[model samples]
Structure formats: structure tokens, C-alpha cells
Target: MSNGDEEGVLRVLVVITRGERGGAQVHVRDLLVGLQGRAALHLAVGEEGFLADEARTIGVPVHPIPALQREVAPRRDAAATRALLALARRIRPHLVHTHSTKAGLLGRLVARRLHLPAIHTAHSWSFSDGISWRRKAFAIPLEAAAGRWTDRFIAVSAADREVGLRYRVADDARVVVVHNGVADTSLRARPDRPGVPVLVMVARLAAPKDPLLLLQALEQVRAPCRLRLVGDGPDRGAVEDAVARLGIEDRVELLGTRRDIDAILADAQVGVLVSRQEGFPLVVLEAMRAGLPVVASDVGGVSEAVEHERTGLLVPRGDGEALRAALERLSADPGLRAAMGRAGRSAYEARFTVQRMVEGTAEVYADVARRHGLPALRRPQTPGRP
Candidate 1:
């Protein structure tokens, strides 16, 4: 590797297909932030994604690969793979780590061909229910084949680890579970409330997120409540249309793309997430850290993050009636909300901080390097090598 004289000062190249404003994207960026000053970091990202802008702002050297899109075009895939291989040849990185599906496949294929150690972290498995069976069947063999090229497999949740085992990507020894973490941003405490129940939902306005169902549940709530939707996406207009159709537009406010999320949570009574599935959402942790009572759908990694009645309430996914009941129960009982919020914050402090995540990932990097025959970490010895 071109990084140094094999003294464990590794060079790492992070390749991602699309770094959009999503949970996985945020987690990868934060991982990079933690690795700063520890390794020589380089990025190869989609030419036009939110991540490129964010990565640039963070002062990482990013190469724009335009063909690395989320779509499945054979020509584009080949081109992006070629670009990645060429960059790997030039960068001579000791370690290549890729996040998300598209990048994981193409980047590892290239990294292995170039005789480099590689790690792939699946924020969530791409092939799951709701997607077509044809896609799932195809993904199985593709991921298994890709697994041969990967050295360490990182799953963001235990459920995802099960999926990896089923797909034959991880047998046991090769797999490690790394929970996602967020920056220790100081969240302003929720201000004293005096009016109607305020419910805050933060998610991309996508179909999977099912923001419309939230509106439906809001309509069913017997108590008066105001809904705040934070995030912008292609589905924004549809969500707005749903609000208008329900004639609850006045009670619902769409606040798109605000960096002042802590302040938003500060003003709300309860924080909610209703995604069809999740891979350990950072927003849930943020809400918990902000000390807002949570009412989220019971899906994927959400149950792992929320403690049901103790830290939050989890209703059956897609059940508007149960969702309405949970919201109303928490809304009517301030004591219950306060108690759950306190527990959630305590959970945040115990498990999910930037420091803990950095240490875990750094240890993983050291392990991967040692397995690949890289030199052990050097101490400023009273002479030199052992």
C-alpha cells in the first residue's frame, strides 16, 4: 500500500454509489469523520449526490464518478466498475470499505481483483419484502458471489445479520455487528408546552416512510394534535395532497430540510417514525437524546432501538388504529411521555455516541489489517522495530 512503510498507517478508500440525504449516507459520513487523523482517507462517490457536497465541505478528497447511479443499467455499471478499478490502481489503498448495495458489489469486486483488503457494510439488505421476488432472487446469488471478495462483513443490525447469514454472505466468523451512531450534538431540551399535542415526524417523504398513514392516524386521534413533517423528497407533493384531502392542512405543517432539528424536537411533545422498515434509524436516537417521547412503527431495526413502553411506544406497522391509539395515549398522559422520554435519553447515553462507534470501527480496522498481514501499530519505541 502507498500509505506508509507497513507500520499500520493504512490508506482507506471509501466508495459509495449515491450519497443522498439518507440514513446510510449520514452514517457513512459520520464514520469518515471519526476516522479523520487516523488514516489517509479518500472518497470516490457519485458525481451528483448530496454526499459529494457534504464530503467536500468536510475536506475529503472526493473523485466524482458520474456513472455510479442507483439504477441498474449494465453499461453504466460496467463503466463505474472500471472507474473504481482504475482509481484503486492509482490510489493503492491498503483498505477499501464500501457502504450501500451498489457500491458494495462493484467496489469489492474491484478491490479484490487488485489484491487489496476490503470490507462491506450493508446499512440494510436491499432485497426484502415489498420489492419484487425477481429482484430478491437475483440479489441472493449476486451478494453471495460478492461475499467471496469481501474480508469483513458489517451489518448495522442483528436482523440484517440474519439476512446476511441466509444469503450466505456471512457465515459467523466473517460477520460483525456495528450499531450506527450519531454526533454528540447538544440537543436543546424540549421547551415547556401549553397548547395542543405536537407530534414531530422526521423522514424522507417516501412511500416506504408512509407519511400519508401518519395523516390517517392523526385524523383518528380523539385528542387535538398538530403534526410537523420534517424532510423533503419526491413524495412531498403527494403528502401535501393527502393533507389537503383530509382537510387537516391547517393542523399539519411541512417543514422541509431544516438543519435546526434539535430546535424542532425542542418544541414538540412527541417524536414519531412510521417507516415500513428501518435499519436502526438515527432520528430515533436523536429524538431520544432530545428527550421527546417516541411513538414509532414496529419494523426492522426500530424494535432494537426503542424499548417499547419504557423508552417509546411501538405500534404494529401500517395499523392506523393502533397508531392513533398510541399517539392519543401518550398525548393525554404527560407523565407517561416524560417517563419514556427520560428512559430513551438514558439509552442514548449508554449505547449510541460518536466516541463508542469510533472505537468499535477503529478496532475492526485494526483487526482487518492484521488479518491481511499489515504491520502492527507502532509505538514511539525507545529505538525501533521488534
Candidate 2:
């Protein structure tokens, strides 16, 4: 009988900066869930939201690093690094895998110090997310340094990989592209809502997400359609105000944060994402799984997920006219919407299932194990044997 220490069962320590409800957090959670039994999982994250609590729900050991924060705080970041070093010494992980930029920096640093194998996953490049020039200058150099400290990097989309290379954040030889995947939890294909077409945007109300572009496009969309903005963030007030100014108050529904994602998808005819930067968004995958045509800005990893004119329409990012035309086109054509939805569902089933994602990630772990010469399970040593 094989136990956790059995042959090929690697012990991995997964780290992320914050438990805030976001894409990177979701990536870590789903990856961990899929890796269960295949690896002995230990999760380290900041005390933020449902990430730690939900991981605990699934019986994964949770370590909350109080000093680890989303935003930069030199003192706290230093403390967080120290805490990670101590945790590494105690738990003694075979390999450290980090998600999100902050944790990626800290985790790789500690692993390098311990002379252990490690890799970082780029959910999105921090510097590419529309930060100030001063911050970008500082972040790009720091990112390069972190890349040097690690063994390999997993990019969830080709767009993400491109950003890293364009900025010289990571070397070409050390990066691999692995598209994000979601479980097939689709409900029945929704009949288009009565009165007006419902276009759903599943993203935080932040600058990178750019909900305002969607609002501006909606204002110009000739077809009478309702935009359902799901999720909230620091830019809610701006988006809300824009909604009023665009005279879309009645046509736009601000669903702050939602748990009924399936129901929401089931009611919508199309999905939209106007993020200025993204790394293979999961919402688009969810929309595909739910059999809805998507109309998203051609930004980041979105093109790789949405096949142009087949599964959805891709418009130029931040181009209000282009985005408006795409949305209105879908609103006016039910047959086009259904055809694209069907194609998207087929694509999702073919390439974006959780099982496929788990397998791809496990392969990465195996390669890391092989390179690091991970210890294999040996039969229990005879008592008193030297």
C-alpha cells in the first residue's frame, strides 16, 4: 500500500500573497484541489478572504502569513520573507511553487536561499497592469531579479509570456505556456433574456479591468442591451458614475460580487471582458463552458481563449467604437450568438477542462522533481539500521 511518502508522491509548498477574491487566488485554489493525493499540499497565503477558509474546508493545511500584503511595504515584505524561510525550515518542502507576483518574489527568494527547487506562475505581470512609470521601472527590475532566483516559470497564456519577454523579466528558456482551465460545471444553455440582451462582465472594477470602456461601448451600442457588471473593486464609484452619465442606469446592473455565477451565466447571451491586461481569464472559460458567445477586448490572453468569429468576437482594447460594434452585432443576431456559443462550448470541452489543467501542472511538478532529484519513498528503514 502506498502512502503520501510513496514513490513519485512529491511534497509541494504553494504560496500566494493574498487570499483576495481574484483570478490568481482562484488559480491557486483550483490547482491545489486538482493536485490533491498526487502531491502532499501545503498552502501559504495572506489573511484576506475565502481562500484560506475554503482551502481549510477541503482539508488542505493553511498557513496565513500576516506580513504578506498585496501592496508593497518593504518592512512587511522583509518580515514575510523571514516568515517564509522559517516555514520552509519547519515544513521542509521538496519544491516551492508560487502564484501571484508578490508571493512569487518572496517564495523564490526563500527557496533559492534554502537551495531547493522552485517555480513561479505568472497569473499576470504586475508591471504590465497599467501602473505608474516610476512603479513600472522599479517593478520590472525586481521581476528580473526574481526570475533569476527561480528555476522555471509557468505562464497561463502566451500573452503573459510575451509581456515577460518584452520587458526582459524572464529568460526565454525558462518559461512555459500553460493556458488556464476551468471545470465543466455548465448549466443548460440559457434562452436569451426577454426584453433585452444581457451581456455579462465578470471582472473587478479596477483600472486594469476597465469597466468604463464597456459602459462607453454600451452607450454607443444601438441594440437595446443590459450590461451586468459582476464583481467589485476600488474603481466601483467611477464605474457607477459612468453608468449614470452614459444614461445606462436602467440598462446596467451592478452586481457587486456574486456567488451565483452559474445562474448569472445561464441568464446571459454573451460575455464581455474589457481588462487592459489579463492572463488567460477564467471568466471567459466559464462563459465558454456555459455556452455563451463572448465579446471581449483583444487583450492579454483573451485571443487564445476566444476564437475570433467562431466562439466570440474580439475587439480592440479600449476602442469604444470597436467594442460597441461587436456587442451590438451579437445583440442583433440570435443565430450568430447561438452558433458562437455552441462553438465555444465545444472548444471548452476540447481543451479547457480542469482535468487537462491538472495534468499539465502535474507534468511541470514532475519535471521539477526530476531536475531536483526528489527523494523517492524507500521502504521503512529497519529499526536501528545504520
Candidate 3:
């Protein structure tokens, strides 16, 4: 249990479903960097993938549990719980912190049974109004059930917190709002390109993302411009179909999973997100960091990410006409885009930073460890004085 120096240190365990290089995974990875050497960090991951390799490169211990499934399956859930329980017994961690829905539910359930303090971060709600009624009903109860097992529920946005309370999942006392933070140094403004405007949308091409909405809205746009869709997902085909059907395929570029997101943001004049719902999107933060104005749908914690007419514009969720108008306004007025982009960069610096995020998460770990009577204190990993 003691992975630190002679001095007593905290032994913290952070559990996650998968450690892929996505928004949630990247956030946790950054937090771990700040916690390294300060705590005995053990990452319990589900099935090996991109995250497993990344964690190992950082010298963090990783435990793989394949039983964790994205879908709701009684048999798999039970097996995942058993696997988690066994891992907990062996690690005997002072605090158990989990991210994502599947890992959060199963990890907290096992932690509660073992009489350990547990915390979960709701990166985004899986039960947004955008999904089918059947899916929402199933997710609400499951999420509500898991809330009872968690000692604290960390939400990335006030909207998500409101949803939790509305559904009777977690009370105000147990819920904490920790806005998503990204390093402000990452922002780089792109030089203006002559001719048509360039609008960018970065997100996993999943169902909830609704990239097709942007494509449809493009038909209504009067200004000449190109829409760059970044990120990959199962819904790529649907998006392509919509673009082709709308005869805007030439204007739409499907740039799947590009490494130059910052570069792309710098060259772009505007950023857009038409998701059914969002939980403080990191892409928006990245866009702000790049000093690119945003035009996102009003859903979930999206309002928190974008300030109407100031940092960026907010359109009604799924409203194509409003979206088209917003894009046109930005495209037509270069001055307006520059002003909004400047405001967005300022917001990013004031509210979002990797250091702030790591510090907040560390505080949570310390609190959970104290409540559960786990070992506290880890040697500082800074180069000068270990």
C-alpha cells in the first residue's frame, strides 16, 4: 500500500472504464500527472486500449477489468462488480475515485459494499432528453441507483447537477460542481484566410453529437464557407449521407481524428457543436484556447462553456435555422468573430487550466481518504527535493 518514500503518503486509487485518449480520459491523465509522487496512484481500467499504454508510459500502475461493459447487461454488471471487489480487497486503497458511467456505478457499488469511501465524476449525462424515452428511463434509474453508493458526485456543469437533482439521483449536499479545465497555453489564434470563412466542429462522431444538424444548417447558410468536422465515431456514415443528400459534400470535410486540433482551431474563424447534450465539452475549451468563436447548441452544460453574444453564440438544440443564422452572422462579420474569439480566450484563461483541475481533484482524494481512514501523504515528485 505504501508506494511513497519513508514519509507517510496517501494511497489513492482512480478507477475508469477505459483510458482512451478522449475528453474524460485526457482529464484524468492530466490529474494523475499532478498527483504523481504525491499519492500512490493506481488506475483501475476496463479492458486494455489506448489509455493502458499511455498510463504505463507515465509509470502509473494499471489493472485491467474486462467485465465492464458500456451497455446494461445484468450478468456483465454482476461480474464487473465481483472483479472490482476482488481488486479493492487486494489494493485496499484509502479512497476510490471513478470516472464515466459504467466505471462509476460498478466501482462505487463495490466500494460501498467494502465500506470504502467513493467518489464519481459525471463527465456528461447519458440520459439527456435528446435520447429515446426508453434509453432515458433505463439510464435515469441506473444512475439514481448508483448515486446512493457514492460518497460524493462531481459534475462538470451546473446543468448536469440540476439533472441529477431533478431525477432524485444526488442531493445538493453530495453533489459538487467542478468545471472542466484545460491549459490556457494551448490556445493559438489562426491567421485569417482570404475568401470564405472556415468553421470547425470537434467531437466524437457519435449519435448524440448530431453532426448532420450542422450539415443541414449549411444548406440554409447564405455566406460562402467550409465546415470542418473533426473526430471519428459510429455515426460517420449518417453524417456523410446527410452531407451528400444536402449537396453540400464539397463544402463539408470529414477530417477524422486529426492530431493538429490546435492548428485547426488556429486557422478556423468559428467553432460549432450541435450535440443533443454536452457535459462541459473539452473541444469548446480548446476552441476558446485557440481564440476561435463558438456557436454551440444550448444543451446540458453547454451554456457554461459558451456565453451568449460574448464568448460565443448559443442556438437552440436541434434548431437548424438558428444555427444557420448564427454561422452566417459570424461568417459575414470578421470584426464580430474577432471580438467574440477574444472574449472566449479570456474566459478560458480565467476559468480553465490544467493546474486548477489537478489541484481540485487532489483535494477530493485527500477528503475521501480522511473520511475512510486510509493512509495519507505522498512524497513530492518535483525534481529538486524528494
Candidate 4:
């Protein structure tokens, strides 16, 4: 399992369940880009989608494990485990890092079998409070078992770390909080638009994310505002039906997955996310980066990024009235929106930049290497060497 490099550069094999355009996938893509010159990187994904494509385009070798999927299929799981084991043996990376649940489970198992150090970043735990009880029942013990094999657990937020601690997934010493970050977007000064204020929510239309609730709230909104739902998922059809059912079709637009999120946010007045569960969503960070005030559900670590009454407002989950009130309040006050948007941008610059996240993660990798008596991981002395 030698790295085969005289320079002692750290070689890390990064794995994730899906290659879709989700928060976790985006995080992985950004990480690979940030760590380009700092380490030798390899990516293994369940399917060929946005992440795999982006990783390949960035010159990272992409390994496909056809059997690695989100659903729980014993046969597929075993096959995926075998495929990953083979890949790990062939690559012989210094360490294995995994994201998302399916990859986290099988990747660690493969790492343990190969006697390699394993690090897992829990984007969101299956056993979180808002998750289904059946899932929690199955996931709790399973994660605890996996935690034993994991050398380090990267929780995207302090709240996520607390969940792992409460469930005994891992001890506090083994888990670290590294908030998700996004590259800063150049802010475009918004010109005054008079007719209707636009609210944008960039999230997959899926469970945990309640686009329908947002639609219902839209129906009751007193302020003249239009809603733009970006990113598509399994629940798109249902969301469309709900939009029509609420008779707010004119007020809602479904812009399924676009690369120009920054442009869209630049034109928008506010950013919103109403989710049942989250582990510090990158969308909120993007919103902050784009200099837009957020109005998100008060769940998971959202409160960590969005300060109540400062950067934006936090409403109770699934409370349509509260959501409407928050929306209306912000819609009516142009001065307040401008002030909050400024605060959000300041917060983003101070706390959630890609450089900070990449360095924090590299530190974790260094810590793992040091404890294992492996060669030290070093960053290139020159900035932007890649």
C-alpha cells in the first residue's frame, strides 16, 4: 500500500454515494478543486452524473461502482463492497474519505479491510431527529458500528456532531465540526425592480425539503412576491401539482437545475429553504455569498449560518403561517433586506469561504496521518500552484 511517490504527497481516495447535483456532491466537487495542488486526489462515485463529470473535468481520476446506490439492497451492497475493496487495493491510497451514507458505510468497510485509515464526512445522518423512526432504528446501531472503524468523523456542523455524540456513533474526540463552505460569488449590484419582489429557493424538490409547504405559504403571502424553485428531484411532479392546486402557478416558476445560480441569485431579493432536516446546507452559504438575505426553516445547523434578526429570519419547520409572515415582513422592507443582505455577505466572507473549509479538512487529514505514523501531509508553498 505504498503511495509510490518519493515526495511523500498524501494520496486520498474520496468516495460518495451519488453523483447528482445535491449539496453533498457539490461539497465533494469543491473539495477536490480546492485540494488540487495540496494532495493526490481520486474519486469513486456510485453513478455517472454531475459530480463524476465535474471531477473528471477537473482531472481527478473517476472510479465508477455501479452497485453503489442510495437504496438498501443486500445484493447490491455486497457487490458494491467488493467493487470498492478491489478499487482500494488497486489505488492503495494513503487514506480513504467518504461522503453521504451509502459511500460512508461501504467505503469505511473497504478501508478497514485494506488496513487504511478511514475518514467519513456525514453530510446528514440518517438517524437525525426529523428522519423516519424506522430509518433511525436501523441507522443508529449501524452508524455506531461503523464509527469504530472510522479514524475521524467530519460533521458539517456542531449540531451534526452533537447528533453523532448523542447516538454514540463516535466519541467527541474522534468527531470534528467543519462547516460547509462555498466559493465566493462576485456580487452584482441589483437595480431597483418595482413590480414584484422575487424569492428564490435553491434545493432539490424532494422529501425533507418541503417545496409544497413553501407553495402553501406562497398562497397566503400578502406581499406581491414571486417564487422561483431551482433544482429538480423525485418530488417535482408533486410540487407542480401543489403549485397548480394552490392556484399560484403565475407566482411560481420551476427552473430545474441550472449552472447559473449566481446570476439567478443576483436578480433575486431573498433566498429560502424549508427542509425537515439539514446539516448546514451549502445553498444557504451560496445565498450569503450572493448577498441575499435568507428565510430558511429553523432546522439542523441553519441557525449556525443565519443569525436570527441579523442576516435573515428563521421560521418554524412546516409552519406555513410563520413562513408567510417572515416572507411578507422581508418583502415589505427594502431597507431591512439590504441591511440583512450586507450582513449575510459579511458572514460569508468571515466564516464560510472555500479556502477555510479546504484548510480545515486538510488539517484533519494531517492529524489522521500523524496519529497513524504516516508521512506528513503538506500544502504546496506557492499559492494557486495548480
TM-score of each: 0.92, 0.92, 0.92, 0.96
2 versus 4: better lDDT goes to: 4
Distance from true location, Cα of 248 in model 1, Å: 0.9
TM-score, model 2 to reference = 0.92
Model 3: clashing residue pairs?
A: 9-376, 9-377, 9-378, 10-377, 19-51, 187-289, 190-266
The digit string of per-residue lDDT tens for model 1 on 143-255 reads 88889988898877787888788767768988888888776656544522666878999899985798999999888787778899999998999999999998898789999
Please provide, for model 3 over 231-253, each residue's C-alpha lDDT reduced to its tens digit, 9 standing for 90 to 100: 88889888888888999877889
Ranking by lDDT: 4, 2, 3, 1
Per-residue lDDT, model 3, residue 376, is 65
- Poorest stretch of ten by lDDT in candidate 3: 377-386
Best by lDDT: 4
lDDT of 4: 0.88
Candidate 3 segments whose C-alpha is farther than 4 A from its true place: 1-7, 191-193, 377-386
Pairs of colliding residues, candidate 4: none
TM-score of 1: 0.92
Candidate 2 collision pairs: none
User: Candidate 4 residues 1-386, lDDT tens each?
Assistant: 12344256778999998988889998998888887757778899999989999988878889999999999999999999999998888877889999978899999999988899999999989898799889899998888888999999999999999999998999989999999988875665241246578999999888899988889888998888889999999999999899888899899999999988889999998899999999999999988888888999999999999999999999988898999999988888878888889899899999999878888898999899999887776654443311
